[model samples]
Target: MHVLTMLLPVFLAFALMLCKLFNSLRTMEVQMGMGVVLLRYESPSLFWFVIAFQCLVIGALLAIIYCAFFILSNQVMS
Candidate 1:
C-alpha cells in the first residue's frame, strides 16, 4: 500500500505524457491533411516552434518522472 502510494504520481505522470503525445500526433495529422505543407513552406518558424514545444513537453514529463522516482527512493530508504 505504501509502495503503491509512492508510485501513484509516477504512473499518473506517465499516463499524462502518453496522452499528450497521442493528442499531439493526432493534431499534427489533422493539420497535415488540411494542407500544413503550404504553411510549412510559407512559415518554417511555425514548424520549428511545434517541434520545440513537443520536445519541451517531453522533457518536462521526464523531469516529473525523475522527481517522482527520487522521492520514492528517498522514502523507501528512510
Candidate 2:
C-alpha cells in the first residue's frame, strides 16, 4: 500500500508524458504532410529545418522511453 502511494504519481506522470509525446508526433505528422504539399514552393532550408526538428524530437522520445524502462526495471528488481 505504501509503495503504491509512492509510485502512483510516477505512473501518472509517465502516462501523461507519453500522451503529450504522441500528440506532438501526430501534430508533426500533419505538418509534414502539409510540408510535402508545399515542398516545391518552400525553401530548401525550411525543409531541412523541419527534418532536424523531427530528428531531435525522436531522439528525445527514445531517451525518455529508455529512462522510463530503466526506472521501472529498477523498481521491480528492488
Candidate 3:
C-alpha cells in the first residue's frame, strides 16, 4: 500500500510529462506553419505538413519508449 502511494504519483507525473511534450510539439508545428506563410513567401505547406507529420510520428515513438522505460525500471526496482 505504501509503495503504491509513492509510485502512483510518480507514474502520474511521468504520464503528464509525456502529454505535455506531445502538446508542445504540436504547438510548435502550428507556429512553424505561421512562420512559413508570413516569412517564406512560398507555398510550402506540403513541406511543413511532412515536417509536422514526422513530429507526430516521433512523438509516438517517444511515448512508446517512455512507457517501456518506466515499465522496465519499475520491474527492476521491485
Q: What is every candidate's alpha-carbon RMSD to the true fold?
A: 5.6, 7.4, 7.5
The lDDT per prediction is 0.62, 0.55, 0.53
- What TM-score would each prediction reach against the true structure? 0.48, 0.44, 0.38
Model 1 per-residue lDDT at 60: 82
lDDT of 1 by residue, 1-78 (tens): 574586687678767766655665555521434554424455677765765676677688677667766765687553
Using lDDT, give the best candidate's number: 1
| Lowest-sum lDDT 10-residue window in model 2 | 29-38
Candidate 2, residue 71: Cα displacement in angstroms equals 3.8
Minimal lDDT window, size 10, model 1: 29-38
Which whole-number lDDT from 0 to 100 does residue 45 have in model 1? 73
Model 2 C-alpha lDDT per residue in residues 1-78, reported as the tens digit of each score: 454575566666666556544654455431444454324235566655655665666566556657666666577554
Tens-place lDDT per residue, model 3, 1-78, is 454564565566557655644554555432344454222224356546655665676566556567656765587553
**lDDT of the structure predicted as candidate 2:** 0.55
Ranking by lDDT: 1, 2, 3
RMSD of 3: 7.5
What's the CA error at residue 21 for candidate 2, in Å? 15
